[model samples]
Target: MGSKLGAAVAAVVLALPLLVGAGVAGIGSALFGGSGTSSLNCTPDGTTTGTVPGMTAEQMINAATIVAVGKQMGVPEPGWVVAIAAALQESKLRNLHYGDRDSLGLFQQRPSMGWGSPQQITTPTYAATKFFEHLTATPNWQTMSVNDAAQTVQGSGFPHAYAQHEDKARAVVAAVSGVRCQPTMAGTGDCNNIQAPNPAAMTAINYACGQRGLPYVWGGNGPLNGDAGFDCSGLTKAAYDAAGISLPRTAHTQYNAGPRVPDGSLLPGDLVFYGPPSKIRHVGLYLGNGKMLNAPTFGQPVQIDNYRYPGDDYAGATRPAEHHR
Candidate 1:
């Protein structure tokens, strides 16, 4: 991942559009009543009900807070699932004022560990916001399994515990936000409807998607190269190679070897890059709707993730298929 090359042209700041949409309304109508306005309020208003089944009114309200904060931050539905799942495992979606050591609130975030003060950490909105912030900061988090993404942010001793709550968490998110996300380890559920720009792009995307769940083997070129999996540039190279387009072996070289895609105009199958131009380190195959298919770092497999995230060092994108044409 650290194959550095010299600088190319000035960096282009990408214009990523916010991915938001109207979710199905009244999924929680039994609890929230016909007026959807009631569910939007994160604060408990005494009229709350266990419309989600198995969860109490208070737990549902906290879940609602988590969903609301994620939407306000423009976090995609998968992120909300991760946040809510972490909350479920940590505090059963209740905003508790006590936990192991200084761990507190719905996420059991430690006040002593810089999560925030007890008062702030106990606040439902504040806790949910903090959880989402950390989750989004994790590189390629959208590609990670719900438990893996939750553990990456929470750093819990019981790392595997978060997985148990994912179904419930996803259910809570759907109930509160009315958006049913069919999240899979292979890709974010939101990207299924996104169409590739052309047959060639579609071919490349399909090729990459087929490689999902493969390990991230640095310098590996996938099964065709006789390795188990792929590296960032290796996966992109292999995907385009399947589409009959040749690309440079490393990320920096590939960035410089582009029919450079203009900023704000990325299309599916475009090769998105990260890090400075002088030392580009990461690359992924754009899968449209702000999602990408890539072999993210060691321990992570080939999977789909948002192309942009908080603290991401996105460089730019290149349309390799354009060069082929």
Candidate 2:
């Protein structure tokens, strides 16, 4: 991850896109809702009945893709609800080609279930659909616990486990519902670059980037950067912290801190940088459109700049592997 960041930051002299999408033009996230903030107010369906707990990067992508595939295949809400719970329990939404004694896919489906070839069963969408199909064939699955409904389709070693993940599954379904999965630069980038981030997310990125042009001083991030201002690394840390993430002190240390974001996979508010040895040098919050907000140097107001510009140096970038606590 450090090496990758170094390579990206070293090439700060490229030309990036001049356009700004404002992201409001795309899907939008609603943050809070329900009678008492119980609703996630999802970026997709508008009202999330449950919540997706913070997960690993792998978990996030798998959950997102699977939900997207479900909706794409016209699988109904109950089917999705059941599938979500099953996957949440089975592998924490992680895609695994091998399962205990050949039980595989989201529902731990078996070849005996007429699920599909091994290849298809491993595919998130195909596997989820097959599980739902069996669920529909069972009697009274709609009213059953997510686990009970899933067990009807898959007789697993631990039948009750799925119940524990129901709320988590619902959260994923709501977040990824209807809205298509966009490829991420991380293994999750829109596989075909067909997706864009939600609008509130865009605004969040803008909020982070709009902070650029601010003076960079040692320890100057104020509430985050410290009272003195900020060093190159301090500036980056400050922006992300304001966006709801606390980070390590140095740029070099920050580089290896969390999930590695692949080139072009960066989202707004993503931490990007420049420097050697895979360490963080200068830091900025990505605002998409090939732009980001950076403090840069002394006496400069944190300002948004184009990643493709020749003057700004960039190393690599990172976003929260999952949601921040």
Candidate 3:
């Protein structure tokens, strides 16, 4: 870890041309839409440059993990933009086992402030998950500007620093995920829906949204049927059922029913899982842009939330076949 961290620092210490042929600089414009003003771009081989150059392979790998974990947690691409930007600013994408005042890992999360223990905070995946969980919980996070959203989560002494890294972060996410970061509603107070590619997916997402504000009841099946409310899996099952797809009762079984969607490739109406491996205990329907339709535990009503709650584990995801139907 120390040597890898050193390699990252040494590589970044040099200057590289921001404009690489058909890589980060070229492809990035297409993914983000060519306003012809943005400086982001990516190489076909996946090396990225623009905002900050000399990104090492190890750093890129960590950036990819952060994006993937955010997706697994139901974080939208914008959320990923903020996360990567912050990581670049805080640690330069290096998962340092050390930092000022007990700060550690990719985001420089602090243990003294209750971020987590040194071990948990230092683990790149765990640190990124913790960061996104806090970020998504911030009110109107999806609507806040990249810097504002990052500051809301990190509360860094240097609040303005994150802005400098957004372009590079977007570039990194593009290179690593094989998906370009799209335009976001950040800072605009419009967490608007991303259009579903097909009718069945649209229908299922709409059905789930229609049930918002309903109470959560354990083992409760459906509001349309006889049952009063719904549990986590119950809500997902019922929503898909309305879209004409059949799903098993338990979260684990439902997870096994469909082709798995990689976290970075999630589409609207996909099933998002939470818990441990095949033992997944909860499920929700992905609604694109980092939110999900959930029937949370006892006291909470059916609503949209950042897919992974604090301390809520991310299992995996599956895309229902109905979406293609």
Best by lDDT: 1
User: Local error of candidate 2 at 275, Å?
Assistant: 1.6
TM-scores of the models, in the given order?
A: 0.42, 0.43, 0.44
Question: What is the per-residue lDDT of model 1 for residues 1-325, given as tens digits with 9 covering 90 to 100?
Answer: 0111100000000111111111111011121111111112122223322246677767766776677667656689899899988989999988888889888899898878977678767767567767777777789999999999999999988999999998888777765664222111122223344344334565688789889999999899999889999999999888888888888999999999988977876767789999999999999998765788999999999999989999999999998866543
Task: Give candidate 1's TM-score.
Answer: 0.42
What C-alpha lDDT, on a 0 to 100 scale, does residue 302 get in candidate 2?
60
Instruction: TM-score winner between 1 and 3, please give it.
Output: 3
Candidate 2's C-alpha runs over 4 A off are 1-66, 69-81, 84-213, 223-228, 311-313, 321-325
Give the range where candidate 3 is weakest over 10 consecutive residues by summed lDDT.
182-191
lDDT of 2 by residue, 1-325 (tens): 1233222321210111111111112112211111111111113334322223475545655555555444434456877878877787777677787787777765566666566667666656456556655676788777887879978777777878778877777777664453433322211111122122333333345344444445666656554424545566666665555546667877778777856777756655467778764545666656555665566676776666665667645677776423441
Which candidate tops TM-score?
3
What clash pairs does model 1 have?
none
True lDDT of residue 292, candidate 1: 89
Kindly report which residue pairs in candidate 3 clash with one another: 23-42, 23-43, 24-41, 24-42, 24-43, 25-41, 25-42, 76-290, 143-187, 144-187
Off by over 4 Å in 3: 1-52, 179-325
Candidate 3, residue 23: the lDDT equals: 21
At residue 118, what lDDT does model 1 achieve? 82
lDDT of each: 0.70, 0.54, 0.68
